[model samples]
Target: MTEILGLYNYWIVIFLMMTGFYIVIARENLIKTIIGLNIFQTSVFLLYITMGKVTHGTAPILKASHGGESHGVEHGVEHGAEHGHELHAAAEGHVDLGVDAVKEVYSNPIPSVLMLTAIVVGIATTALALALVVRIREEYGTIEEDEILEMDRNS
Candidate 1:
């Protein structure tokens, strides 16, 4: 039950995705189809953002030392020592290069950045689609797919 509850965001994403898909497939109106596409896009964005989250995580920001001497290494070493651990090299057989192991857990920023780009692209695509729909309405006096098909058949 706890495991299922923890995946609430995934459930929401699936629901929105199916709803959007149904709207696009079952509706005949051009406007409704565009709205459905937008819904689908939103669900994808939500999924990416949700996947990028980490438990008890923070933004990946490195704090610089006020003085030019220590360079934050002392702080890392002190933190590790406080936790009853020693900072070690990341790999075996490699010399300890004095690099501090950052114990902070940080959420990945890539998914959010990619989603932002996708949102801009989605908005541009939707605008183009709506403009095309308007032109279709002007030409056929209707935006219904069935009506448009009937007109095409009669012509």
Candidate 2:
């Protein structure tokens, strides 16, 4: 229960998802539908970004944190020194990293990269939709679905 309570990011994502879904389904206007799609897109982005985040973590390019700085590394090296070959390896500059020194908490980048692609696709889709809407308006003088339907029937 307490653990679930701590996950507020998930809660926010869920809320956004529901709201976007409602807008996409309930709206009648073409412009409103696009706005709803954008909201839905934003919710998905938030979800991806939140999932990619690491708690007390750093970028993958940086060294991993083992709770503290190189303090853990010193202890690990001292331990390795007692292990014969490990000491020799260190002396030759061929440093063998211990578990503590290699402990990493990197933010996974796949989600962000995937989201970037999604954003590009979304932009293209939105531009296409707006262009179609503009063309429709020029031909029919209105952008509403009901009006278009009535015009189609009359024609």
Candidate 3:
């Protein structure tokens, strides 16, 4: 059931992406297409945030107190206070913290990097599209693609 929930969330993200794609493809207005593109980008961002949510994983920073006082080797033991927490690098390739198993899961950095790139791309596309819209407005005094087409026909 938990797996199903995760799958449902993923499906929702995919649905958002597809809806945005459809809107872009089916709409004749350039501004509407740009909106759809933004929607598509937002769906991808949602997926990234959802996947990056770690239930118990701490920050990647290894502070002096949070680790061992001697050699900084984390055996994954929870001390009386949160100050003495050490990172346990399991020998079997799995660290068990006896409480939250999520801390053992390796953090994925790819999605984060990809999301950064995607954001930049989305911004660039939006800027370019807006510039084109401005030019179209100046040329024809209207933003509707169909109206522009009619003007062309009349000309």
Candidate 3 regions off by >4 Å? 1-3, 49-55, 58-106
Q: What TM-score goes with each of the models?
A: 0.71, 0.69, 0.65
Clashes of each: 0, 0, 0
> In terms of lDDT, which candidate is stronger, 1 or 3?
1
The digit string of per-residue lDDT tens for model 1 on 1-155 reads 98788998799899998899888888879999999999988888989988998999876454343233244446656665666535452122122322332345678889989999999999998999999999999999999999999999999
lDDT of candidate 2 over 52-86, digit per residue (tens) = 88888766554534445456556656866788678
Top of the candidates by TM-score: 1
Candidate 3, residue 19: CA error in Å?
2.0
CA lDDT of each candidate?
Answer: 0.78, 0.79, 0.72
After TM-score superposition, the amount by which residue 26's alpha carbon in candidate 3 deviates from its true location, in angstroms, is: 2.4
- The 10 consecutive residues of candidate 2 with the worst lDDT sum are 91-100
Model 3 scores a TM of: 0.65
For residue 75, model 1's alpha carbon misses the true position, in angstroms, by 19
